[model samples]
Target: MRKAAALGVAALALAAQCAAAAVPVQGYAIKATYPHDPQAFTQGLFFKDGFLWESTGQYGASSVRKVELATGKVLQKRALPEKVFGEGIAPHGDSIVGITWMNQAGFVMDQGSLSIKGTFNYMGEGWGLTSDGERLYMSDGTPEIRVLDPKSFGEQRRIKVTVDGQPLAKINELEWVEGQIYANVWQSDRIARIDPFSGRVLGWIDLSGLAATAKAGKDIDNVLNGIAYDAKTRRLFVTGKRWPKLFEIELRPAKK
Candidate 1:
């Protein structure tokens, strides 16, 4: 995730997108809340085997962590280089793959030990990342998301995300859930559920109530961001930068 939200991609942009698409926004009810590190400037997040894997940004504070979902315990972590800003991470095979901000350099790590194994390269500013067990998906703070080869990191294709033919820019913190791409519209309390094939936003998940901090004039940069899904149990979790709690939520119809 970039340190600051990009220009022309704020709450108003999201509102405009919603208006243009006439898309349905789903509300959510919190099923459970768990502890999260207040210091983690979460950029990437995912769930696997009862654990949450997170990547946090900030030049000096960047690190990749494996945390306990129940208590938010940092069971393992690997601090990134002091000058490199971590962006997003996805588990690829037996190794974990991650990208950095502005450098175009990505690294692979031993999944179990959290030690560096190798590195790869890509083009563009990395923002969010995820996988569909066969290929990888990456967002670059733009309206388009890139599909890359898992091993070579080569761009295979690009998906131009749109709502009523208007580009949904600044796509960040991605998760692949149920064969669809779930993305956080940067600095907005809206998550777009996109069809990977058509690039059309099927609907929006309104997190405005959960993102009350920004509305209350608290941390503006700490708006809604991260998303993770536990497919086995069909649990969806969402959180934000510096948030003290992570919530497991179930989507429900918006009230009239």
Candidate 2:
């Protein structure tokens, strides 16, 4: 009886160690707030050449716009066809690429003019897109992140995101930050920092209090979504679908 009890305790200890090995979720400290278009249902956000490029969804309302970060003014805009629901936007070589949800179609546009230059098709639902200067990374509303050939827009490889060896699905918006892939899990206020090569989730950023600060009585789809980073300024920004403000945040190690 004593031997069995000892073995049980040992097993419990082992299990505790395994649980402790799970990656931790970090929290963010808001650094600054910037004006954002409250009507825009932001699906993808990025900073480029002193402008904030955004993709807004909703079939009849979808658009790709370059906005002034301070004034929230649409500097340049391009509307998607009424039937297409825009999902994500990414900057490629000298052009920009925008994807549509469920339509399985994407558009390539001139970065300078935001004019449609060409179109490309893929097989699944488009969710998020980002690039690391050479290759394109995309999410299809699944745990898988597809690496695409920038030239042909063909899938070159895939990385299945996992946290503590368990697959994490609904990986939404994506931003390649400092060699790690930062992703928004749909409907969650947490962002996962993942290893691009290993698909291991290194940590998570919790932005729980952000949406609550929105203007009272403003009815909006407030799920935490957009993520953008400025490598030169080392700034990180996050916002939500129809959120009135964009926040610059700094991540801090979460307390155990």
Candidate 3:
């Protein structure tokens, strides 16, 4: 009888510990208006020199496009061959780096002319990609980030991702901003802010209930992907391929 009581107490204590370990919600605020889109399924996105560049995906449906933010108009578009499906994209100095899903090839394109400059190879499947001025970060649908040498396109190191003792996997659509990595959880409406050095999730940006928004009612992408940051303007852009609109959001702490 005494042992049973002791076990019960221990189980209660563990439950209390788990409740205490839950990450707290601080607060939240919206910075700007949400943009609208007609076609969803955004695969890759990046902001460079006041322009928003995007890529869409599927087996045979993929493209790279430059969009005007205020108007949601495609200023320029270059469709990928049906054989090459597009993934995430980022800016490396004056050039744009884009990845091809399943093709194992990535391209460095000229920003002004939209011409391909070079191609490089990487191991595993490329799902999402981004750059942090110096090093390139990639996701292979794993709970880790593989740092690549920009020049050689070779692996430098990898760090596992976790938040509050929970492993966060299926990370897609990556963006590096202000020394941190931001990733979209595949097939969900949540974004995780991760530490670049330790791979710990610092915070989470819950995009819950976003699928029911007015724009989502029109032409919602099946899944969410793509994130981009504008350094000069401090703007964060998010979208999915075939999504009706891209959003420029200002994130605040969740409510307490």
Candidate 4:
């Protein structure tokens, strides 16, 4: 009887995997294109109030900046210290919170001035970060996302990201868009649209061939890595590290 029950459970799990695998992969329509700094190794991005706030990576080259959307011009910038490699950033009330790659220490910047107001510490590596206006969602290069208190940046809970009942690794550069979490799968050209609560990958935005137009330099690691959405106008944008162009794209129906 015990052996029979174990086989039953395994069959049920396989059925779940098949169902999840049937989730559709989506395509996109390029609504518009704008210039981006090819030198900016984009790590995180958010759109607000007609401007783009971006966080860039690389040791001794990390920075947070406010850029004009139309011209790709950096209007305001603040460079991080040489010792820390920055990862992700999100806005919290009147400030912007930023996380580093491995230092486990993140900083809070005043939104109006881009000045470091304070610092906070966490337990593990920080890769990508986003905000839903209430809580902060942080990814640590694993399949799990840590839900954090926006005020204290304290870990409240975790959500394990999975596709077809399997873990999805190298999740990077997250953005909370229209109640769903859109994440870039590191080193891949596609983005995963995930359910924040269930941690289930609802679908994937297959962005194949989009990167070829960005005119990225010879750095082979400059895969797609940034996403930003404007809540006011509902415009979705995507780009890559050291990419020369940023695209405003509209989602089409999912493909088989």
Q: Pick the candidate with the highest lDDT.
A: 4
lDDT of 3 by residue, 1-256 (tens): 9999999999999977775456543223445544545563577888887878887787667777888888878788777778988888878888888888788999888878778889998877888888888999998898988898888889999979987666789999999888899898887777888898999887778776545542455433465577889989888877665557666777775645
For model 3, what is the C-alpha lDDT against the true structure? 0.78
TM-score to native of every candidate shown: 0.89, 0.92, 0.87, 0.92
List the candidate 4 regions with Cα displacement exceeding 4 Å.
1-21
User: Which window of ten consecutive residues has the lowest lDDT sum in model 4?
Assistant: 213-222
**Residue-wise lDDT of candidate 4 within 1-256, one digit each (tens)?**
9999999999999998778659888899899999999989999999987899999999999999999999999999999999999999999998999999989899999989999999999988999999999999999999999999988777899999999788999999999998999999999988999899999999999898888877776688788999999999999999999999999999999875
Query: Pairs clashing in candidate 2?
Result: none
lDDT of 4: 0.93
| Every candidate's lDDT | 0.89, 0.89, 0.78, 0.93
Look at candidate 1 and tell me the lDDT of residue 251. 96
The segments of candidate 1 whose C-alpha lies over 4 angstroms from its true place after superposition are 1-21, 213-217, 254-256
lDDT (Cα, 0-100) at 6 in candidate 1: 54
Q: How many backbone clashes can be found in candidate 1?
A: 0
Residue-level error in angstroms, candidate 1, position 219: 2.5
